[model samples]
Target: MPLRSTRVAIGALAAAAMLATAVPASADDGGRQRHVNHVLLLSVDGLHQQDLAWWISHHPGSALARLADNGIDYSNAKTTFPSDSFPGMVAQVTGGSPKTTGIYYDDSYNRALLPAGTTNCATAKPGTEVTYFEQLDKNLNSIDAGQGLTGLPGSILSMTGSPEQVIDSAQLPVDPKTCQPLYPHQYLKVNTVFEVARAHNLVTAWSDKHPAYDLLQGPSGNGIQDLFTPEINSRADAAGDDWTQANSLTQQYDGYKAQAVLNQIDGYDHSRSVKLGTPAIFGMNFQSVSTGQKLPTSDGQPGGYLADGVTPGPVLADALSFVDQQIGRFIAELKKHGLWDDTDIIVSAKHGQSPTVPAQLTRIPDGPIIDALNKAWNNAGHSGTLVSFSIDDDGMLMWLSDRSPTATGFAKSFLAGYSGNGNDINGKPKPFISAGLATIRAGAQAAAMIGVPVTDSRVPDLIGIAQKGVVYTAGTSKIAEHGGDADTDRDVPILISGTGFNRSRTVDQPVATTQIAPTILHLLGLDPNELQAVRTEHTLVLPTVG
Candidate 1:
């Protein structure tokens, strides 16, 4: 395929340089010769810098420790706030926050979009909830995503990177302007590092929890040539196993994706059945750690940290060990293929689990909050539901049916005085505070924080910030949640290891994961400015590494 016109001249130059050079290396700090032919970007979801430091300190001989021994570990790396997985992952690849990405969470509201099945865009009122998570799957219940093939996991493994096959377009929100369903990639407002790599003709691949991760494909919709997404929310067994319900089950689920990375390292596709060559840019996200940090065992063993809130409990420790072992496998396979010297490994997290301290956890049902708003709006003679769409985890984001300032102010005022008794995940009664309205953002305040204009339809009219230890789910399935402004939700680990890094070094300088996008392109001998988000946000490469 030909390169995009904007990069055609640079692509030709790069092509000619590759023909003339014999495995040349890019020079970094202290005259380090970095022969980075491949970049392995791994997101160990829910991994915090503290967790990584504790694990490495406890296990000096571990693979992660070994990588850190030769890596530059950024001691303070923050992810995007309202830190849901979608926005967090998009921030890393696009070098932009929710402001520029036009994505807040997997489930958000888009005022410019029509209903999923709305056939007539011209006449219908434009506004609908955007659900890009597992709902888009062909079969949310099947691990294979119900591709309708003979084999079980193998069928999902052999997918030809066609997201359309796994995703049901009819379920997606329709673009009123085009009267067509908008895929995850089309929902994105900026280009990604994967798109930049493809512009340079480099092969790319990524494995994650859901097919909805096709959002990483960027606006071009073909950034990743080999995208393997096995649904993590699908049943783990025919007996109806939920992967996220248990730490052990989550580990078992993550193994499939770990094996896919190994297959890619072995010069085959995700299935290990076809020789597609190792991707220049490839990686996967592990969900075990995230699961362990939030869920307890089926037998009632607790998850999260020990009493100190810093040490990983038995469940979390096991989860961390599983991921470390998988990392060891990746390093081993890379070495076995004689590609270790040419590969750079960047490890980070999409988002971190909040309220590491189990004792601080307080569960509250989000239903009452929405119910109060809806009732008040109806009582005031407003038509339809007051809150059009809302997705609450540790935080509450509400898109109103009537987005007027009067409606927003009325909702905010109600929440400011809202108080009730709720039950914990264990069904123990607890008192609920007024949704922490002191820190909450509404109207223009909410828009400013999101980096969007107040009139932008995508911006939430009111963002209710839950208390530090408050979780919105009343279910006993999880003790903690993400998508909040807590330090535990946004503070994550960022490790740039492999060939070029000279020695073990921990820098205390604060950085954001968005810098990873530009840094990856810079390390791979591609122009960082080629990424639209990087240019729009003026994102710089990671300090020291770049």
Candidate 2:
């Protein structure tokens, strides 16, 4: 592994303002060091090392092949623990862990949140979880308000789905016990690289699945210059584009947003008229791979049967091809614009999907577990806050009712007795949770298995990892899931290419995505330590660069 001598060219936030006056590309220390001014960060929701291998073994002439040949490849790159999308993405940008970012998953129970939004909290629906996948604010406020580039190449149109979860710290119904504001972003204890870049007046732009991703904005303002997202949950189609085509609607959504990156590369944004020129940092996440992970063969060629030893079916192949083609286009556009040399492109994924082997699919329903917990909470006669549940692929996140210790104890006991089978010790297989009560434990033991801290605020009071070869689902979604410590869930493809480095190199040393934030800053000749989270975490920048 090689190390680059990194220094903070901008001493302080104030220095950032002073230097902000310069154009997109600037020199470091009176031109003593060459700098890569532009950085395009692209994330595939569920890209895995295996997927890349499949592409190489299948499509020999893929853009992926070109990238691997041109830049440094981290053959062993892992995402943050829990491996959920929210935490995975944050790991790259915040250079921190779930504990540092306080983002465990997109869907996790936060009793700290105002139990309910504008709606009421009821037993049937535990309102404790602050779903980061929000499309609209609790007030139904549109997410399009000034979220995109002010001036546009085209108007940043209003998006469908929920809007940015508008937060007026003053308005949130504070938790009576904690009396703490329940805003999601507020929970992110540390800042992201996005904010650090902005501190020096660097322009950054990003497009994700939803406005709720405003979390990337970090606590401090100045994260993105232009942020564009179409409500991911919406079924609406872009004009003249039929989502019903071979392209999965989800793939279509991802492709649509990827086009935004194309526009940004071309010196503008979805705000067609606003001349963004080229942002210092910009990129978008692609969901095509994720969509392919779950697409069943019944769905057709675009539908894939991707599992261990399984060459991608037609659908999976199509998905990979689509992504490869897009990457080629991105590279070509950068070259055409002549910004290719000044820009560094990092193609990676937030996390990997699980159970690549179809035989490993184990669908364990949550009905029994939920029923037992609810009943126990009722028996405890405590605050009676119903426990909230989040099933992350194979891992389970259970936020026990915010009641007395009695309620939690009872819930735990019931879980302990559960066996997905009838009895814990040796009972008959439970009906719904056939593998239920498989392994019920918490604290460090549970966290150790999944690689998350039991003490993490975002961690659930009770985490359930189904029995080996078991998953928590009823065969509705994809075959393999993520969010657990499964190798299939953690190993992701990491490629650092484009203008800065020469000749491709492969580093087998394991690197965490946490290093990417600092790596970006380091490439641009900024002090990697300026990113407090990475600095505080003692994260190192990636090895070898321009």
Leading candidate by TM-score: 1
For model 1, the run of ten residues with the poorest summed lDDT: 14-23
lDDT of 1 at 114: 90
For candidate 1, write residues 377-426 as lDDT tens digits: 78988777777767677777777777778888988888888888765645
State which candidate has the highest lDDT.
Answer: 1
* Candidate 1: stretches off by over 4 Å: 1-35, 298-300, 424-426, 436-438
RMSD after CA superposition, every candidate: 9.5, 10.9
TM-score of each: 0.92, 0.79
TM-score of 1: 0.92
Model 1 / residue 245 / CA error / Å: 1.7
Give candidate 2 misplaced runs (Cα > 4 Å).
1-34, 117-127, 135-183, 237-247, 297-299, 376-392, 402-413, 420-440, 444-457
Per-residue accuracy of model 2 over 1-546 as CA lDDT, tens digit each: 000001111110000000000001111222225578898898987788777877876777788887777788878888876777778888888888765566777655554455444343322232354545542333322223324433221333433212233433343434544555445455577887778778888777888866667778777644776777655543233343222223466565666677778888888754445776787878988877776765444244634453443567677677788888888888899999998889888989987775566555555545545665566566767444356544435665565545345444566577666654331111224343423434555545444544455554455665555454444553344355666666767789778886445577877777788888878888777888887776667777776654
